[model samples]
Target: MSPEYAIEGAFSIKSDVYGFGVLMIEIVTGKKNRFFTHPDHNLNLLGHTWKSYNEDRLSELIDASILESSDQDEVFRVIAIGLLCVQQYPEDRPTMSSVMKMLTSNITLPRPKQPGFFTERKLEEADTSHSMLCLSSSNHSITTLAPR
Candidate 1:
């Protein structure tokens, strides 16, 4: 669930891209994004990845099992593309076709902006078991009776 769809109930192809991005990160790290935890930080896997990438510490995020078998540069590029997919806005993500080309080509990859869902969550504010969305609570009342 991309942040937009999760919070606003708006869905699009970009929503799937966000999902794919999460998949990519999990594949590379061998950790589930939702359940991933770090000893020093409360960042989810996606947030951790964003922080690692920015710090040029992506090497720390790769699965050691895959590291030996995979080309480091290629893996880094995939991670970068994954980051691009999970950017803060759906409009910022590339189309699926563009993603494919990026994966296959050596073209210069754009620097990804901050990722969505990268913030430390306040679990108390919402029911984490059902949803992480924090929609504002409001009430409505009928001031007058209407016959319609």
Candidate 2:
């Protein structure tokens, strides 16, 4: 939603893609990707899923809590939809309408490419960049707000 990444007048379809990916992760893991951390590298849920997927361990992305609530076929379908939402190229991502159909129907989905910020290394860099400016501005605000 930040202007830094805006494609047009407002946050574009790609932004929705990011949101869909987050929702998918949340649905599978019963966890929020923003705050979920991995035991190994302290990576967030998205990074953890990407790592697992890369290693051909897709089932690892699923949460035990959802085992009863989730249908295996539906789970796989949603996972594929999520991956489509997070594709690096905006053009490759499906619109919300397409996403809805993909989720509800038995349509064959396109394979998703490596997602943006999929790797821990890339995610770390993105996290650093995203926070650096905000932190610096907040510090400045604190100094200005305090008695001099």
Candidate 3:
């Protein structure tokens, strides 16, 4: 879930764009977002991707299928666009039309900021014993809107 949806009860077209970014990552990595994990860094897929990108090790995040069959530059470009869509603030994300242009054209893209929900805690640090207690659960279902 996007951080805004999880923390603020907010939903909009930008939220769907965030989901699209996640979907792109899943396709490129051939991994499920829900089950993504890194034992050493205690990061899910998005966090790991950000870390890899910042460290100049994004090749480690690509699926073998893509690596063997796709152009590396194109793959990297798509990943960058995905990260842009999942920025922490909705306003920081590009519109869907902008995304299409980015995908199809060679225009320069803005550097992606850190994504939402990014975490770097160790596995031990993630244990519930040290976590804050919350009295209620946040709903994760996407609220649908009818056409105006």
**Candidate number with greatest TM-score:** 1
- Residues 1-148, candidate 2, lDDT per residue (tens digit)? 2121533345565677667776876788777765565657866566676676668676677887676677866786677688777766677778888988897899998877766555454556647855775678643543334332
In the range 24-79, model 1's lDDT, one tens digit per residue, is 99999999876677777778889999999999999899999888899999999999
Candidate 2: C-alpha RMSD after superposition: 6.7
- The TM-score measured for candidate 3 stands at 0.80
Candidate lDDT scores, in order, read: 0.87, 0.68, 0.84
Task: Please provide, for model 3 over 11-121, each residue's C-alpha lDDT reduced to its tens digit, 9 standing for 90 to 100.
Answer: 867998898899998899998665576766678788888888899887889999899999999999999999998899999999999999999999999999999878656
lDDT of 3 at 99: 93
Q: How many residue-pair clashes does candidate 1 contain?
A: 0
Error of 2 at 125 (Å): 11
Task: Rank the candidate models, highest lDDT first.
Answer: 1, 3, 2
Instruction: Give the poorly placed runs of model 1, Cα more than 4 Å off.
Output: 122-148
Among these predictions, the greatest lDDT belongs to 1
Looking at model 1, which ten-residue stretch has the lowest summed lDDT? 129-138
lDDT of 2: 0.68
Compare candidates 1 and 2 on TM-score and give the better one. 1
**Cα TM-score per model:** 0.82, 0.68, 0.80
Location of the lowest summed lDDT over 10 successive residues in candidate 2: 1-10
